[model samples]
Target: MSVSPRRLRAGALALATLAIISTTACTAGGGGGNANGGAATTLTVNTSFVLKTLDPGRVYEATGLTAVHALYDTLVTFEGSDVGTPVPALAESYEASADATTFTFKLRSGVTFSDGSPLTADDVVFSLNRLKNIKGSPAVTVSELSVSKTDDSTVVVTSATPNPNVPVVLAMPSTGVINAKVAQENGAKDGEDAAQGDTAQQYLDTNSIGSGPYVLKSYDPSAQVVLEANPNYWGDKPQFDRVVLRNMDVQTQKLTMQRAEAAEISLDISGKLLDGLPESLQTSGVQDTVYFLFLNADPAVSAVTSNAKFNQALRAAIDYQGIAALYGEGAAPGAGLVAPAFPGTLPEGEASTRDVAKAKALLAEAGLDNPTVTFNYPAITYKGVDLGTVATKVQGDAAEAGITLELNPQPLTTFLDEMRGGKSPLGFTPQSLNYPVADSLINNMAPGQATALRSGWTVQRADPAVVAAGEQVTETLDLAARATAMQEWQRLMNQSSPYIVLASNSSTVVATADLTGADYSAAGWQVDVAAVGRR
Candidate 1:
């Protein structure tokens, strides 16, 4: 349900104790009043693996993105589920070079950070440069680009290559502009030494300085985060006076929401939890993430998995529809490498149906007799669905095709280490992208990329046709042409690749029926906290 961007690997957190829940119920409940005796509304959101960091340049995890998104505003942003289009946020307007190599932005006038400092082009330049130099997980988002200030209200970004998605990249939470003066005073640095010289993470963990709707009031990585409305916010005032995000496990989340405990909204909820849900709660979702199975192609790791025919057999044996059914509504059989929410995906019916006969035939053609393989996966629940449960289903399906799978479930951290080190011959995990762009997904899954390399599929060993198609997609500048290239790439990948598309689960959010505007988006910030309001 999350990755390295929470993209390639999802992290895990221990379940909160019942005492913590009781404490949260007392402190973070909704519909309360302030000391002045006036109505003060608070929205409580339940989620796990949050509060990793508040620094925008370093925040890449799903929940971390959610926090940074509220505290900071990016130059461009996706509006209300329209992730395909990027609109100005901190920037009033922007222009891109015809070749798509350069972009110039005009900062919105009269915007102020939480500290009441005027927004300046220097802040935008400092933020982007610091993001690149921090060498954090999110730094890769701007690795190919350079940013500079041209004037007090103008900033320029130049790319090393034609990048039609630069605007979309700017919308990423990692690019959120910060108050440079305050950040510098707190030890934030720019240039190549920022990875070591930047020391503002600790300070930023509890303090926020941005031109967004909410400001950080308190942060406790082990418990919850508190936010208050920013009085100096330049945009529409938020309806809620405060918001609280609590860290709770999936079962706890389900229990809390179903019982109307302390939270009004729940994140990372599985579709299975929606069954017989009370009418007092409403749900909204989008198919924003995919769980996939990949077999390492490195012969040194596993000769059996390196076999092309065996890979084909494994793909054929998987019951894609059955996996989708596990998540219930809002889930679907994954059609290609890309998640279903984005464009360039294969049509729904195009996914291969389970064919036991074909799988057995392929295995026989590979000259393997009842080949036994180790299927390794994380032993944790992701977005309410247990990975072990999914792995068990896959194991059973493989058995039907005359294959034996020795399921090895490891802790999330250990599993991630082994997977990233290419030690797992066969692995099952979910990859969630930082942004909702087809090229970002393609680049991550393409040959010689992060996902492929993690699966031991390097350019030297990858199919020339598939590699060429991926290159074409990245090199194309025109949107229509890029889409065509992406399609061809997926076609070739499906024919022969280490990864198999399994199921795309919906990014589900359940909110109290009294709440309105709890919309869903495929972006890093799954739900726009600033937009939620009581009916």
Candidate 2:
């Protein structure tokens, strides 16, 4: 038996099941957690998001990807609101057979890599094939798609199936193209170094060769990363001469934003910071971060947390209001796995409701609500929890549901180790599913102690349904069938909070009056800087 992982709930919902809850009133700002009103001429964005790697192929970490976007561009991309639809970036025009399996792309003629080599069909094929051959970040993104370069200027991508979202996947920076010459000459891996070539870690420490709007200038560990505008950029020149990413303490970064050292401030604010900031300044709560306790779901260590009822009890017991208030600065209550625009997009009280009754019922069903559990939190320097506001609120809420929740905060690396090492009983980490593909997020939704990429969490927890649907969508070269299949996929994830889906944070951004285009989503994914302007 093939296990028929694809058979979700039997009947599929007709194309429309539930409209994706628009977190914003359809406005990027509405869904964003920042008070990004300034139109500064030069944005001095001071973020702790130091560049760990410049290689788009393997830079899956949030902080790393933030820097990659500045120095690289992808083939196909997305516009506002849509997840899979393709929007032009590197590719000027493209043609796909009516069946949607084979796509032919025509690259702009004059585009050149940062290394000065002209971009062409060969480069496109080289990059895609490299990604497919590699075992790192972008590999999963490009895994199922088949590729071929028809000629010097045209590349054809053939999918196992007809997929409308192939363009979206292409748009992803992980699909960012690299210079074949640079990769060859240095005996280095550009991006596909993860599984095969040289590894992103080896390549990015010293080299960056892409056909992006910006070119790499310098990198100094976690201290700083600098990029000068690529003069040979295929697109219009950026408004700024350079973009600098700096590393600083969360509190200092906040202060820097207040004092205008940085053009922007992003928040995944910790309770400790919220309490320490000047009262007047503290109230300037920007919608910046999401706070949710993730269950590592280890059968041996976290049997209770892994229980569906336990997950329900914990979520239901949460006093979303109190925690939000504890974080202060006018933090709003969070709901579901996603955060919605306050007031209009998400009706007031939409996610803030406290259902004590529902919680109690869940705890009783779990038969172990009173079970003792310790949650490992990332450290303070990185805005990791101090275990007071968030954990306390959770502790109190869980208490109401007859469960005892304990907090144990550790350094980021240590906490990461316990969770990834497959030893953590319970870990408090926040996660987001940015692409709208529920299956892609299964790594974070492990029911059996799923390991993260860096940490040892195993990928075995990936539901067969998720895997099948994911695979089918990639291989299916037909539209109606793919759509029909995806509808079922989305619904299954919605019903299964196997990961105990918590709040999807809003990325709050505050910038000096100089830089523009520093929008962070409520979900913390960096904003696309194609149209960004800097003073």
Q: Who wins the TM-score comparison?
A: 1
State the lDDT at 513 in candidate 1: 64
Candidate 1 Cα deviation (angstroms), residue 75: 0.8
Model 1 per-residue lDDT tens digits across residues 256-321: 888883338888675676676666676777777778889999999998898998899988898988
**Residue ranges of candidate 2 with Cα displaced over 4 Å:** 1-43, 62-64, 78-85, 95-101, 115-117, 160-164, 188-207, 261-314, 327-334, 338-352, 361-388, 408-427, 433-438, 442-498, 521-530
Encode model 2's per-residue lDDT on 186-236: one tens digit a residue. Answer: 554434443555544455544567877766666654566566667677777
Q: In order, what lDDT does every prediction score?
A: 0.79, 0.54
Per-candidate RMSD vs. true structure? Answer: 5.7, 11.5
Q: Could you tell me how far off, in angstroms, the CA of residue 41 lies in candidate 2 after the best superposition?
A: 8.7
Off by over 4 Å in 1: 1-38, 261-263
